[model samples]
Target: MAETTLYDRGMATRRSVLGDAHVDNASAKMTEFDADFQQFITEGAWGSVWSRPGLTKRERSMITLALLAALGHDEEVAMHVRATANTGATPDDIKEALLHVAVYAGVPAANRAFKIAREELAKREGNGQ
Candidate 1:
């Protein structure tokens, strides 16, 4: 059997969670400046962390949403919220996580995150996702 490399695992995991369109768009936009950065996130975030066995993708999705919301990473929060469909994380799960973000991170951050999440959810609902 062939040994799967970290980048390979990462690419697969990233594609599964983020979906092909997002990955392909990002790949199409890749350049010498960000090539290494992309590789690093694939290997580190997707391969090392997201591909781990202990947590369900659903659980990880919740945790990721909370962290991104707490950090006020608006775009990342939006992306991960969309990713919830693939991760099996429900709208309620996102609500709970953002509630934690409000308490632990601050109300302002959570408030903004809630708006983004609501918008993303609306888009997904409209698209029949």
Candidate 2:
């Protein structure tokens, strides 16, 4: 038997947190133009970083949300917000994280993040989740 590679481990962790459906959708849409970028994120972000033992997925989710929001990565913030379902992050936790973003990263960033987070949460609830 062969030992698992970072890509394999990353795919597993990504699927667990982002869900098979989302991961499948991403995989299906991968083109040559973005294939390398996709692999990099899987092996580097998901495999090496997210798969670490330092923090629970829930804590990582919160930190990810805040950082994404602070950086104005609106789409990623929304995606990670949806990922809260798998990460065990609550709505209140999201709110608190946004508050921290407001204080440290600025109210404008947090304000936009709050709107994005609300939309994502509403979309999830609307889907019968």
Candidate 3:
């Protein structure tokens, strides 16, 4: 089978997972300062891996949270936790993922992730969005 076009597949998956506003903001921020990095994530992460059908977005989101938490990627972890609302990953799901992270990735990582998740979830809960 022929490979899917990167732009078509990547843009669709990006919008589906990240939401329009977040994607638009990221796009707007992609200037000469980080154009290459932006393109790399769009083509590699969104297009290549996320476009695969092996797992659902919910599954992917959970894995992402765990990996981000493990890697001490606080900013990305916060972003993914916020995205849980759009990705159908409930607060309970995040809790479970952090529990796993605590055991495997270390308690410190999970503890920090929990704080971030709690704050972000609260914001989302208040807005009812």
lDDT of each: 0.97, 0.96, 0.90
Which is superior by lDDT, 1 or 2? 1
lDDT, residue 82, model 2: 92
Ten contiguous residues with the weakest lDDT in model 1: 64-73
Candidate 2 at 30: error in angstroms? 0.6
Q: Candidate 1 residues 43-105, lDDT tens each?
A: 999999999999999999999999999998999999999999999999999999999999999
Model 2 bad stretches (over 4 Å): none
Q: What alpha-carbon RMSD in Å does predicted model 3 have with respect to the real structure?
A: 2.0
Q: Considering TM-score, which of the candidate structures 1 and 2 is the better prediction for this target?
A: 1
| By TM-score: ranked, best first | 1, 2, 3
Cα lDDT tens digits, model 3, 1-129, are 786788668878999888889999999878998998888888899998988998989999999999999999999998998888778998999999999999999999999999999999999889987
For candidate 2, write residues 24-48 as lDDT tens digits. Answer: 9999999999999999999999999
Assess the local accuracy of residue 45 in candidate 3 as a C-alpha lDDT between 0 and 100: 94
